[model samples]
Target: MGENLHEIWLKDALVFLFAAGVLVPLMRRVGIPSVLGFLLAGLALGPFGMGALAERWPLLEHLTFADPVAAEPFAELGVLFLLFLLGTELSFEKLWSLRRMVFGAGGLQAMASVIAITAIVALVGAESHAALAIGLALALSSTAIVMQTLTEEKRAAGPVGRAALSVLLFQDMLVAPILILIGFLAQGQEANLFGALLEALVQGGVAVAVILLFGRFVLKDAFRMAARAGGRDFLMGLTLLVIVGGAVFTAAAGLSLALGAFLAGLLLGETEFKHQAEVDLEPFKGLLLGLFFMTVGIGLDLATIWSELGLVVAGLVMLLAVKAIIATVACRAFGVAAGHAIETAFLLAPASEFAFVVVTTATAVNVLDAPTATLVTGIAGLSMLLTPAMAHFGRRLAASVDKRAAGEAVAETFPDLRGHVVIAGFGRVGRTIARILDAEDADIVALERNPVIVARERKAGRKVYLGDASRPEILAQAGVAGASMFIVTVDDAKDAAAMVHAVRRMRSDLPVLARAQDAEHASLLYEAEAEFVIPDAVEAGLQLAGRALAEFGYSNEVLKDRIAVERSVEYQRAAAPPA
Candidate 1:
């Protein structure tokens, strides 16, 4: 039996590697996210896909997930690792900062989604208790898929991603209580909702407190000891022990293993080993997440979906639409911009991986029947299938909404601002520019999109305003008419070009100096009327070469002449915009 298990494991690993090795890269080359590739691979390889083929063709047995049940443990590990990686990116300070959004936007999003979905299901003839269970189940958006997809898009730190993470954190915390509530709902006349909630709160509190305390006291020392005792192998073993142990301990406390792992990761993030730990766990995380996605696809139950095709389609549509509207409304209520709010809503519209768990728990407790559970599970899987497509549409829609908002915005008043420099993007580059100009006593009005950063800079007595600089209204408010120069230090070259273009349109003679991400971007900025475009790579390379020349005992005059010649003859002429 052990040998058979090992043999099966070997075969499954090969299939997984095949997907990652061949399927994922092929998808990427065609402009598809790897998340979708994993999902599609799972669906095609699972019982509902090629597994169906294997039943007819014995030769195809090796190509499919012949036993998807065996994949669950690895899939669970995938989710835990993914959360742990996410936790490493976050610190407690960041978590505290996100508290308002977590409770305000996230809590409200879940509550509204549950209430709306329950009412709709009840109206559609489901029993009130069952509707409530199902509604709560469907309210959750997939943390794994959402995080994975957004991270792939390189937006994990962007506005929409941060907002989504806040809501996802709240949803993760709610999982334990919701499971308890499902149990209570199942009991019908004998159920004690308050009692269940109290117990859940107590258990959750104890688990969290224990994790926090141990993280503060024991975890670091243990890791330090392990590292000192051996090396990478020891460190990796310790890492696995902590991840798996945390999951076990919390699951024993009646919470999800993924939650425990996430908390463990959150604590570990504060330590010195955070980056190393992330690097060590990432390969495992990717494979496990792929397996988890495949397992979800395996649960699609094609027979049930095919038979109730109309009803299934209706369920999916209602599920995604209801969640999207509720989430969007909740986000808007919390002062999130229309574009970000709508984008977050669409990204989170799908049902979570935990929906199946909820249905299974509810059914086990007799709150819901087998048929209903099957239908909801199928719908949840189907909705997840739409995650990548929804994300693409959401991004385009968000850009449109933001562009419109920027165009319509009434610029904030900055009275008595004249002959100053307008620094468009108050990030690292913008901050440096402001400091240099301030040293020269050059009056400046810095415009930044992130309000938090603006507040921080403003607190430090810098001139910063919260607004997109691409808008003409914003440039005028920043004293563009009287300003000596326009400094477009925004990170994205496209944005820098827009800022340059906006300033040039208002004042054709204003010197537009911009930072470019690359040569191509520099050309674009030049085309947009930037008088001088600094390509980061070019300047960095020159600085490095100058330092190397100095180290090699080259004279200062020679270095200067070579640098000037290279700038004029080699790099700049190649990258320069047309005359």
Candidate 2:
């Protein structure tokens, strides 16, 4: 029996791995988000899909998830890893910096969404408790889905991303109290609801404090020791240990496991080993998160949805509309820009995985009927599947709004900006160059894709515009034609090269300086007609060598000559035709 059980598990694992490793990539190549691809894969391979026909054709069993619920625990781990990875990207300081938004915007979004949803459900004739329960469940958005989409779009650090994350963070915090409230409702006035909620709040607070303090004080030292003692293998093990250990600790306190993992990520993000941890654990995060998305698809009972098609559609539409309006209002009230608020609203309007948990618990405790729970779960699952499409649409809409505003500003500001420096990307390298030019009283125009950076820089009186510099229109609008120099400091190799190509098409003789990832990228930029290309690897080596010579007290002239010779040799090698 044990051997057979292992075989069943292995079969399911094999199917999922194939989806993650093969099917997802194919979807990505054609412009589909991996999250949606995994969802479709799960739906097709699930019991409702091919599994329903498996008994008649026994061979089909090997390809389908005969027992989808068996994968739920692993799916939950996927959520933890997703949140943990997101946490690593965000430091405690950055999180702290957003405290006002986290609490203000996040809190308002959740409360308003719940109230609006609850009213809608109640008006549709659900009992007060059932309506409240449904409202609470759907009030939250899927952190896994939203964060994954933002990460894929490279917007996780932008204003819209930050706004959505703020709301999601508060939703995670509400998990404990919301579950407690459901239990109180289940007791039918036999228990004190306020007392129960307060107790839960206190317990959660204590648990969080302990985890944060321990992580703040000991996590860095522990990671450093692991690196010193065990190298990469040990560091990887330690990362898993920390993530799982933190998750378990929080789960023990009746809090969300993802919360603990997020805390662990925040703590470790502050340590110097952050980049290494990110590289080491990214594969695990991706595979597991894919599994989680697939399970969501599996849970989508197509038959049930079809049977209650009208009601399901109504519920899904109502849930999305109500939440979107409320979230948008909440964000705007907190001073988020109209574009960002709208994007965040759409991204978060979908119901979360917590809805399934809440509905299941409510049904089990008799607070909600099984039929209602099933319907709610179906709606939630369908909503999650729509997340990727909604996010994509929201991003495009937001970009359009931002670009329109940028266009108006350019018309007003760029008429006489001649001989200026047009810098692509307002990131570290671009900013440094802009500062040097500013110090010299030179005119400058900068273009960047990140809304948050544009907002911040614009507030600080910089001439930063929100648009991708790789596009010829954005380049032309930025006055690249009239500028004396064009600098490409965008991090993505493809984007940097595209900027060079775009500029060359417009002004072949423009002095274009670009930052490249390595020798090959430098060669590509040089071929793209960039007048100057600085490969990071080559520059770092030259700087290291220069420091060494300086430390040895070499004469200034000798050091300069040695650096010049090395730079010339490296540049020539980089520009040479590939062998």
CA-RMSD of model 2: 4.0
Q: What is the C-alpha RMSD of each candidate to the true structure, in Å?
A: 3.0, 4.0
Question: Per the 3 Å backbone cut-off, how many clashing residue pairs does candidate 2 have?
Answer: 0
Candidate 2 worst ten-residue window by lDDT: 407-416
What value does the lDDT take at residue 476 in candidate 1? 75
Give one digit per residue, the lDDT tens place, for model 2 in 73-111. Answer: 888888888888889889877898888788998999899
Model 2: CA > 4 A from native: 217-238, 272-276, 411-414, 417-419, 466-488, 491-579
Q: Report the number of the highest-lDDT candidate.
A: 2
**C-alpha positional error of residue 149 in candidate 1 after TM-score superposition, expressed in Å:** 1.6
Candidate 1 lDDT tens digits, 100-143: 88999999999999999999999999999999998988999998
As for candidate 2, its clashing pairs are none
Every candidate's lDDT: 0.85, 0.87
